[model samples]
Target: MDDRLSGYPDPDFSLGTLARMGSSRLVTKAHSLLVTDARVWPAPDERLGDTVSILIVDGVIEQIGAGLQAPDDVPRLSAEGRVVTAGFWNCHVHFTGREWSSAATAPAESLQHALDDMLLSHGFTTVLDLSSNPRTTFALMRRIATGELRGPEILTAATGLTPWRGMPFYVKADVPWVLRWLMPAPATSIGARLTVAAQIRGGAKLTKLFTGSYVRPDQVKPMRLPVARAAVAAAHRRGSRVFAHPSNRPGTEVAVEAGVDALAHVPDETEGTETLLRQAAERGIRLVPTLHMFASTVTTDDGYLAPIRAALGGFIRAGGRVLFGTDVGYMADRETRGEYEAMRASGMSTADILRSLTTEPAEFLGRADTGSVAVGNRGDLTVLQTRDDPSPADLANIQATIRAGRAIFLRDSPSKHTADAP
Candidate 1:
């Protein structure tokens, strides 16, 4: 849609608020971008020379060199020698916020603001929605895919399956009991299989299981091992990865025995966790240490925080893959700085953290093309404002979040930046 047609009077809509429309609605039309004078870390383990320029054409990296020439018409962004790397990915998130209820038909401006505030502004180019309403999630996906909205690439699991008679107390308190009772919690393997099959058929590319749900803060209900196995089998048969919410040791046991791909949380309970989690690591099961979620929502006391952080450090020691996620929509606080700090306390270095946000997620999703700044990779990149040559402890200091060569979220105004004229 043209600016006049959309009723937006801003002349720099493409270069400013909304992402530039590509020739093809599906492809972001090469938000045709060029970045000059930037230090680069192609990947966490691989570092490239400083002061390099990357040329992107048609949403793909065409070249990376200390000097690169481009057509005068292509838009150029001066990184001012900031640090550039592969785009960041948040492996867990939710689109269940009430604001997203209108995702399908919400005004672009309104929705864009909410998106920027929650995810993009913090440097997310891609995200995985663990569980959300299919109606809202699919609608959001369609609009973003068609170039109607500027947002991150979304992978959704739709509604998640819970154990029979199991619904988290927190979730139950949010709505009327009658409506909450309608939520799915399968008792038998057959019921679990059908739900998994139907959700995937409904366009949920991923599957989530509340293998353990908090009946009360201190009490839990574990999904039947057989039912969990059925759900995992059904999802894997369809080529979808399954994420599990192991609220405690029992839940972790169900997730492990049932063969879920990843543990969505660190199993909020500590007893018997270290041994089981190490076992999980040995099985090639990945973990998303939403440690910050625990710190913020639960207790910040050492008794609670120490054991949780220790579990994460132990998992990493046991070679468990760590994928970055904040449980953002589920928790009201969206800032990522605390998560990084907590991860560091868990003994992860700068490189370890970066890998979790980038390479690890790309590898986890079996997406070979992304999570690195290579010439042939997708033109998705995150630029961070660094005072020195590519070293930043807290990744929250984002200068710009670019997806497929388009600047979806620019922390600073483009006009004020020094760049070559188009």
Candidate 2:
């Protein structure tokens, strides 16, 4: 097997090879850039123009309009009639395994390849790791922030909280010892609250709870109500949003009653699921429809997918805020096309799907400056090679991914150029 393809370093490799291949340039330095001839969508609901030019300076959008000009020193990238939208956010992801946790210290070639294949290639500039080792994940985040690593802006929930004896059967049997150490089971309400405080103090920006834990294929154990309540209250007091993994209907109820800000998935479609979804929406509980995760786990039959689709459709119809997340690191399928198709099958409009990827998640994360292509916003853009009025699936046609005015991942094409004269 090819060592590079296997994500292992070659003994014959050296810094010269890394420099010659330009892996060092994978993370572009923040500088001025001019993007021209782009079909710009300022926001999911707002199309700016059919053809537009944007001026980016010092990692922020300085101007956006037609025929924009910049200094001679500023580089120009032509969109070539492609669609440019704000960068996408994957709200459900993980940084598990040795490859991810050691990203900061990994070889440049391996780390850059991993980032491109796992995250940037999918146009995700920001990601929320639902569950991961806080110390390692945060170290990776710091490396990215310092431009030592080429990756997305990451928000980690640190170690996730579960009830005593609540570890999922699959995880207990399949997950490695390193990952298992990250998930802690707090047996009591006091333990739950204390765990929440400790995680937050350890630099967790968000909190996650396994309100419903699947101990077996036929059995799910729900967290105690008082414990759930205490965890939520503690996280809220620390100004961190709490996300719940509701494995079933009973788990969804516990999460709702405990006031979790988001449901990590659309709960199992049982009787009264619609009512539960409606209540969740009324209570302002957002949902991350990890529909594709479910599809990947079960047999691809109507009998299996129908209920999940119906539940997602009902949640959408009830005006629930949906976030796009593919459970990438944990599930091992980084491609997002399946998730997009599943969401489209659930009757989500292209606009709704785009909002879930961009605007809604940005707002959910309290990042008013991102998720839009406008002057003064962070110059995080996803350029897609698609025709006018592209469908949701067209999102897979990524041409380049720009974060903070730097081209992190650009698809190779003979005609593609990072800089062109206007």
Candidate 3:
């Protein structure tokens, strides 16, 4: 293993080793035992696996597959009939925390806590906080890493880059003024790019930009291609990926041309052309549909989402990468709420939805060691209460959230069991 990635202890230092180290207190087990017969998704070939035991040891997956006896000293959880998968990732999010007036400028500490609570409660083990003042964002992330806060893994950009006047105003009250603050002056964008470089210098895993116009969704004034290119190039040079927010066809085209690693959202009202999607596929770019947020807000009145949905379906059919995400601002009641709904509404299959929420986004975020329930992945699992077709209400039914190998969210609600089970 490369020295940089060598920090994790040897796998042999498994649960048994930790117990011997007097650190057994750090290890925990799943709350309720689930002994499911088998769980498969995405037609089973897209990295889904067969029956697995999925032992959790110190927040990491210690072992997988059946018949591995839990040590007599350790507690056992038999989750028969309950499917286990990696926690979800919301790749596109805005951190305004929970306050109404000071949300945009909320203290990073407060926002990180609330955001962590929301994501963990919703079963998202990882989140790429798309837009934030990168300095503060990284500080919060540092806190999470140091156990100063409790939350999912946070990946963030220093500040989103866009022309000084065209940024979106998502925060409540005086949002327009906040736009003025977020817009990229040549100096500001340069400073922001430097901030991004600093983040890379300081160990940021990714970067973000508002490459396309946010002024008016339809009247797309794409960011200057050279400027867009520069931001992405600089980030890429630093071993950090860049994500762009583009909300129109022209803007999407610009993002693709600029070679941004990911798009925070595809064009609204305008469905992507096959050519565009194909080009994006060829470039190995990723798309965060943020379908739920769009479905709930922007596409609500005009019915503009049908084409977006169809476009996304085409993209999926074309084997383009898609990640699950919801654009959330603090204090919003429905933050991170519409992923499953939008997937169902868009006619995505259960398997596809599961992959989008799990493996797909995890892979995109460069977290190959997470997302799947496997031998060495992080033991972050979300166990829903049922195997039946979930209703909209089921969105709230996260029976348990296992972080690392420990149960973090265990629901006391009744479960309606499915027929196909252990």
**Candidate 1: tens digits of C-alpha lDDT, residues 1-422:** 22111111112222111122211233334567888887888898975556899998878899999789999877788778888889999988987676675565778888788788999888999999997655556667677776777789888887788889898787766545545544668889999998888777666778999999998887999999999999999999999999999988999999999999999999878789889999999999999999999988887888988988998888989999999999998888888888988988898887888999999999999998899999989989988877464333548788888888877777866543333121
Candidate 2 per-residue lDDT, tens place, 1-422, comes to 22111122223333233233322223434656788898998887876468889899988999988888898878778888889999999999977644663554567676678788989988998899887655456556666766766678777787678778788786666454444544578888898988888777666778999999888888889999999999999999998999999978888999999999999988864556678888899888999988888878756788878888888888777878998888887677778888898999999877888899999988888999998998999999999888477688988778888888777677885434544111
Error of 3 at 36 (Å): 9.6
Model 3 over residues 300-370: C-alpha lDDT tens digits?
65367777776676666777777777776522544544667666766676666666677777767667877
Estimate every model's Cα lDDT from 0 to 1.
Answer: 0.81, 0.78, 0.58
Give the candidate number with the greatest TM-score: 1
* Clashes in predicted model 1: 1
Rank by lDDT (best first): 1, 2, 3
User: Higher-TM-score candidate among 1 and 2?
Assistant: 1
Give the TM-score (vs. native) of candidate 1. 0.90
TM-score of each: 0.90, 0.88, 0.75
What is the model-wide C-alpha lDDT for candidate 3? Answer: 0.58
lDDT of 1: 0.81
